[model samples]
Target: MPAAGSSLGKEVASSGDDLSKRLDRLEELVRSIAGDLRDVKQQQQGLGVAVLRLENRPKSPADNNAEVSANGVGATAEVA
Candidate 1:
């Protein structure tokens, strides 16, 4: 009947609106997560640079002596 068809049409329209709203919310969440991932990647790059600098820095004689003692090798040798 006409009344039944009208009710079904209204239901379909309401469902479509609900789906659109949910899709909008999903898009916002995806954007926020992408921004967060970019920040984390930048921080990781900074840490990598700092680690590389430390690794390339020269070691003092005392540091060398300590490392030698820890490894139980050349413990008696003078560092000069």
Candidate 2:
């Protein structure tokens, strides 16, 4: 017959192993989320830079004429 204390010891060791495995999985999930957040922030920063470049770009002839018209001023359209 097995000793009573041996069964209890086995159960305690099994529970500890299960707890360790769950903790490892939780740590992996946290690392994955942190990586994803870094990627999103990088993409967001690129998008902002693109928007700034567009906003600071030189205006074309058509854009200039449009702005003049929007201000209720008469603009002569140049024949290209």
Candidate 3:
């Protein structure tokens, strides 16, 4: 029969190896999550710039006329 001390030592060594493998897997997952976060941040910045450009763009001719009428600009008198 194997000594009790030898069996306990083997169990401890096996547990240590399992723990090391789990830590390595956790590190890989963290790296993957960090990369995904960076991609999302970059895409968000691009979307912000696109929204700003749209907001600052010139209005179409019909839209301009509607705005002018709404603001009572360039009104003319009607002939009887």
Q: Pick the candidate with the highest TM-score.
A: 1
Candidate 1, 80: how far from true, in Å? Answer: 26
Question: How far in Å is the alpha carbon of 76 misplaced in model 3?
Answer: 14
Q: 1 or 3: which has the higher lDDT?
A: 1
Q: Which 10 successive residues of model 2 have the least lDDT summed?
A: 1-10
Alpha-carbon TM-score of each model against the true structure = 0.83, 0.77, 0.72
Per-residue accuracy of model 1 over 1-80 as CA lDDT, tens digit each: 99999999999999999999999999999999999999999999999999999999999999998998999997576788
Instruction: Give the candidate order by descending lDDT.
Output: 1, 3, 2
- At residue 72, candidate 2 shows an lDDT of 73
lDDT of 3 by residue, 11-64 (tens): 999999999999999999999999999999999999999999998999889988
Candidate 3 lDDT at 49 equals 100
lDDT for each residue of candidate 2 in 1-41, tens digit (9 for 90 to 100): 46878998999999999999999999999999999999999
lDDT of 1 at 62: 95
Ranking by TM-score: 1, 2, 3
RMSD of 1: 4.3
